[model samples]
Target: MDLDSLTLAYAYGCRNAGDFAINEGSLALLDRTVPDVDVTAVSRFASESPEYERMVEELDGVEDGALVGGPITYDPESQSRPAQLAALARNGLQYGVDVAGVADDLSVHSALYEGITDADAMLFNGGNAIHYSPSHGNLPYLLAMLYPLQVARRNDVPYGLLPQTTFALEGVARRLVVPLLEDAEFVMTRDAITFDYLSEFGLSTQLINGVDTAFLNGTPTAGDPSDGESNRIAAVPRFSTLGDTGELDAAGKRMEDTFLTYLDRLVDAGDEVTLTIQTEIDAAWAERNRDRLDDIGVGYYESYDPDELRAHYAEMDLLVTMRLHAAIFALSVGTPTIGVYRPEWGPKMDGTFRTLDIAEYAIPWDGATVETLEAATADALDEGRALSQHVADNVSLRNEALVSDLRTALSTADGFA
Candidate 1:
């Protein structure tokens, strides 16, 4: 089969620089496998936002593309209850209208529906799309994705769910997500946990164990062990509602206290601690904790360029981060990372760490203490070179498997070789 003649609609493309890195890496892999294939990105944001504009810039020269206005607005936490309800109602109505063939060309819904209908194949980008226990407030965001997915299935357009993480699903979300997974031409999960979770759903679709596509971000540049004038450690912070049940906030307070104590230990030890922000949400957290972080003399880094970000990670001797991509960036470049994991953050961190044979470096958020963090940091530094080589080898092996699985999925879908 001539793959150049095929057109693939890539969905869930985002503005987050880390996400862009994954999409860019995935596209590069796809291009190498099947040269000159036409690809169009279907974003989850409207064209007017900076998110969409950034996506356009990143996708420039890749292939032809269109907007298809995203169903959910950014920052759902900030929107009023009535406003959220109205947006949900609007999307629900629009999807119904489009499915009924009553949508006019001028309507955004019509354009979105048409993008899927016109595609020869659909590729959902890698991310945490499944929720294990979504609050009532989170249901709408999950529903927003269903319309496009259902449309693709209804139209008989072959679709694949790329490397993704699934936490827990229940109630309405489980009902909708299970059917969607069942309909996918193939499903590639980033970790064993997610693959096992989806397997329980009894979906007939072929499932493949895959690593994060971001591993294709290229080979790691070895860092010099002797050049360490200062013990540079990159620490990433996250803003989480870990225990917001409208009751006692002890869990939240404990998480913050532990994190600060960990940072304080590093600073007191004469290490040059830097707080790196991966997403806008992380930026907001950093700003809110500015005074606290400032008192400890921690530096800040805020950038959207993945190459620049990876370069920053490369300079660090060790990375202590709550963000998955930050850990990935560090590992990709031979810098050992200590991951902080919380139940609310899902399984990506633990999964990725385990996949790379570095689970010993992971610290559970609730169980974290200054002593534990300090010990982990020391261990990472002592074994840095060995750990780095282990990660590099594992990443290379997984990347090969990922590309192979992708090829098999595409060939199976095309019904030709």
Candidate 2:
């Protein structure tokens, strides 16, 4: 079949710069392997982004559609939590959390629904679209993300997923989503942990081990280093220290204090430090810690454009970030990056670092100290050149494999080649 004749429906929701980077990378991958293809992006907030508008017109004529019949509520004691846990436990989820809000129905945007049903093929772009969260079981979020793909499935249209992170899944949630995943023509996971998680399902789809596509979307630029002076550093902090409840509990307070103390030390050492905000979540955390940040007197860099954000990372001599994509952008451009992460999300960060054989640089936020941060940051700076080359080579190799696999998947999709 002629590639140009293909109408590829790309489903994504941009909530952060990482989301934008993933979308950019998805488009780049398609451009490389399926040039001139007709692409339509399905986003609920299409009106908010020109990039989304350029690919597909703003969403209109949305319909209130119900997929399942049940009560929807946030109360963990509701029948939904236990039922979901029981289902997932049978499928291999050992210990599941019950914080995710329940959703019995989906508000279907007409454009997204029709885009999948009428398109020649569809692909769900990457992120943590399918995952179990400790704070929220993610059932409602999962339904919203899966609604488009479900439409494609019901219409007998072929679909696939790009590289995505998978944290957790269980009972009712697993039962509802796993079948669709198993039936995909192709599915690629962004990390080994996710790949292994999916392996337990014994999916018939061709499962490919892939890296985050955002690594491919970056344009590396080597910045000038400080000549024997304090290094220029950019830190992208997340609200993970506060846990899912968003309350400043004892442990959470300790983590936050350690982080702030580390920053204070950085400032004391005369390093040209700056706070970088890559998402609304990061912005909120900054606001929460406004007084602390002000006392430290560090500068701030904020932007929503993926490429612009990448350029910002490229300019930094060293990047200390809790945001996964911030580290991704910095490493792609050869900047030394130290990832500060919590266990709930650390697996994904560690998986990315492991790809480049730099897992040591991904630090655990729990029991972390100013000394640990200093040690990791110092080590990363010392091995900057080697780390950069390692990342570049690994990303190049993975990107080639991704494109080849995507080409094969597209060629073999039902009613395609």
The best candidate by lDDT is 1
**lDDT (tens digit, per residue) of candidate 2 on 93-211:** 11111112112144323445555555677787787677655455466556656665676676677788888787667777787788889878888888777888788888888888887
Runs in model 1 deviating more than 4 A are 2-15, 64-86, 99-109, 242-249, 414-417
lDDT at position 38, candidate 1: 61
- True-vs-predicted CA distance for residue 257, candidate 1, Å: 1.5
Candidate 1 on 219-280: residue-level lDDT in tens?
A: 76456553655688999875465322232257656877888888888888888899888777
In angstroms, give how far residue 193 of model 2 lies from its true place: 1.6
Q: For each predicted model, how many residue pairs clash, with residues at least 3 apart or on different chains?
A: 3, 6
TM-score of each: 0.89, 0.80
Q: Which ten residues in a row have the lowest lDDT in candidate 1?
A: 239-248
Q: List the residue pairs that clash in candidate 2.
A: 87-171, 88-170, 88-171, 99-137, 100-136, 100-137
Relative to the unseen true structure, what is the C-alpha lDDT of residue 112 in candidate 2, on a scale of 0 to 100?
A: 53
